[model samples]
Target: MTLAHRPGGHSAARRRALLGRATLTWPGLAYITAFMAVPVLLVLGFSFLTRGRFGGVVAPFTLDNFARAVEPVYLRIYAVSLLIAAATTALALLIGYPTAYAISRLPARWRTVALICIVLPFWTSFLIRTYAWILLLNSEGPVNRTLLEIGLIGAPLRLLYTPGAVIVGLLYAYLPLVVLPVYAALDRLDPLLREAAMNLGASRARTFWDITLPLTIPGALIGAIFVFVPSLGNFVVPELLGGGKTVMIGNLIRDQFLEARDWPFGAVLALMMIAVLLGAFAGQAAIARRINGTARA
Candidate 1:
């Protein structure tokens, strides 16, 4: 007679609750296990194992791959990759923060369109986009032609196939990544906080520093991670845009896997990439926690 005992109603409700939780978590867990965690484990295993003839892993385990990765030649490439990634992150932040701020201040009617424009490039194939830069920056390309026509120089500037060009390509490809999170953060910020600061006799700059900036740091950090991690491991941009002259860790990994036919070494490089990405994510999480703690206090 009681609802709890009527026709398995309570059992059905419990089953539904369990099913709801399973439905919510099953897709994400499956994805992580299949694509992220398993692949990462495979790489880690290969890093510690010996490479067999022609790129397969051998039965023996060894640390030689990791040891070899730290040799001067490879270390130099890693250092350069880190430098370029850092530079790209910095440039993306500088360019994206202002754009995000302007976008955040736009009327609501225009904001969605602005965001679409920011993210629209992501819809295109990344390789195709990089190749487009190839056409634009080539010696006989439109950019060079315009510069020559304007009498800026006697010849086309060597705009492609340099480290600077690689950085430029990276910044172009990743700027939207930095902008989107920043816009999300800034849009969530309360404008009245700025007004409150002003009411307390704070200057616009001071209000920004003390209120707006802190509130948006999380978003900026998110954007920086988005730019930094991928830029660190990018091979296509440096290959196509840099014309195979600029070699980063991603290129190194590719060479090991394909050209050198050394799976163990490639696995080591892959592990290092994962480590760097994880470190970035951990750093971001720490900063976010600190920010939230400060807000709570």
Candidate 2:
């Protein structure tokens, strides 16, 4: 019998194909379930439980942890962290958009070189990079010495261990994230669209403002989320740069767990962070879809 003429042949082949795909994916699925999924489930459970007298979680599940996280003190940290993240996102976009546009205008070979330079920082350890920033921004660092020599300031400015330093560090850390996505968007953009706009009497600036920027909004949003999400929860940059003065939600969560031994409250904070991350992602998706639909229309 021919393949088409054979009853149940299509179903049998489909089952085999599905089974083959499942076999291929099982290892990754098992790993994710075991490591990520199970841990998240545990955290969720812990969030609802009570903290033990010493450390660890206990029974007598209650909703008070979530309530405690909403107090004025914790809320202030959340606000500060959000504002810092917002500033970082804005600065990254302002800096990265121009940078990505410039790189997009470069020769293809040069574009690759520029991108490599943007991402080269990742090769080093993150902690090591943060420490490097501390060395550069410290009171006796080159930045202050240069300013002093140039008569900009008589004394060395306190650059390190300040909120501004933290912002700068976050910006330095996440700028590459912004650049790569924006560059990808600009790379995918058709040259013809810009040409057509110019052909129709649009100025170069007008062409970009009208056509280029709108189309690249999705990428910019993606980059913004990329920077904002991590910046919001980043304790390291703030710790190294802000010197414990600027307490972010991340630091608060860490202290609750390690110092206060309040695992339940820490889990609540973690859950809140996760929820915010999800919201950011969902909003990005919704905005991207809306922009895409608008572009198509």
Candidate 3:
């Protein structure tokens, strides 16, 4: 009789625990559904629906926009955007990892201050930062004048409104994003493990390559996503810095909506961006699972 009563009591406790978890998760679920899920579904629905003679979407359904999106020219634009985004991610990683590691190794009292300094620029307007780059890279700007005075080049070199300038702006804007996650990972790492590796005669480089890098990959991957996504979808950088010559997918989308008055085409571009983001999410999940499996081992 006691055993029978014990099983029922345990079942009741399990139900209560499950209910508590559900209650805690409901708010977040609702928030995501309201903001993220709804917006995505709306875009998807709009992509299939026909566009009015003007820029607006009509109620009727069609696949004409998506069909057009697969054309060779649009496909090339997508490819270029992917390539640029990948390059930006790589550059951010190259700079951010070392910076994060350095910060993580700093005195405990200084770590917070260092991180705040890194993040301080983000609190300001993103457009303002990009505009500042425009001013610096302009033909008669301080950078050009200094280079000319130093005889580094014969002329201003037309540095502004070019692909290289766009890339430079991207790196400057997104460097902090990559650093923060990497710093978090390094901060959470067990210093004793690194010391143990050193004591076992592993060189510093070997320890970092074998132990530190593998452990820190999840955070690095997150940083890559953070940099890649925005760079891929960035309009301001291309507009202000690219001088309308370097046409990216983001610019194409803007033209479709504003100039061409093609809302359906814009929706299709939006869907493509969503697909890329989903792919990034899947990659992150895979990396995280691999990290967890290695931890278990």
Candidate 4:
């Protein structure tokens, strides 16, 4: 028999294929183990330990940090963080859905232009972008100057240091994330389905509600999760815009680690946040699997 018909040949081919996949994947696996897994394990270990005398942990390990984290004061911070994250996710979805749908409807050449506009903000530094918002929202900035010129308001208003400003910053920062995913979903949709609906006497709105919306729900959910998780843990926008007035879980964790010199408690907070992060990732995976399953069906 030819080599192709031999069992050893087939086994050898399988081995070569496995070896090639291993070669391709090992670098990524090694990076994750070194950076992500190892750091997470270190943080987990530190969470149960006692705080150090000066800055580092010298452990007669204890659960006090975890207990401290459940206190009412920190719970309020958690609540505020959740509220801000939810608001950001809602606003991103509200804006991103239509934006993505519009992009999907564009001519192929123009679609690229539209997407470039959507993500153009990313070309600049995030810190720089945040600072630019500060300048625009400041009392003497162009936003207020335009309002003054138009007689819209008597004053600049306290736009710089508030929860609303934080939300605005977050929405601006993460809006592209929502738009990209929703656009993918909309782009993948078969036009024939909408055509068939219209042919069957359904209106455009009805077709979108009945067909397009349901199909793209996975993408929307993925985008929402993407925006929500980061917004929840974000500290920078709240600090710069909220001006120390809006305190979230991220700020709390930062303070515990850097300011208060309580690494154990900080680790506890990080651990809690990591739990939420892991849950978000799991949900994202489930949505992806559902999308794949739907595509297969």
Give, for candidate 2, the lowest lDDT window spanning 10 residues: 1-10
> Which 10 successive residues of model 4 have the least lDDT summed?
287-296
Off by over 4 Å in 1: 1-8, 19-28
Candidate 1 RMSD to the correct structure: 2.1
Off by over 4 Å in 4: 1-8, 281-297
lDDT of 3 at 100: 96
- lDDT tens readout by residue for model 3, 163-236: 88888888888899999999999988899989999999999999999889999999999999899988888877
Backbone clashes in candidate 4 total: 0
Pairs in steric clash, model 3 = none
Of 1 and 3, the candidate ahead on lDDT is: 1
lDDT of each: 0.90, 0.91, 0.88, 0.89
Which candidate has the top score in lDDT?
2
User: What lDDT tens digits, residue by residue, belong to model 4 across residues 25-61?
Assistant: 9999999999999999999999999987888898787
| Ranked candidates (lDDT, high to low) | 2, 1, 4, 3
Give the CA lDDT, 0 to 100, for residue 66 in model 3.
87
How well does candidate 3 score on lDDT at residue 239? 81
Residues 219-251 of candidate 1 have per-residue lDDT tens digits of: 999999999889988999889888888899889
Best by TM-score: 2
For model 1, name the residue pairs that clash: none
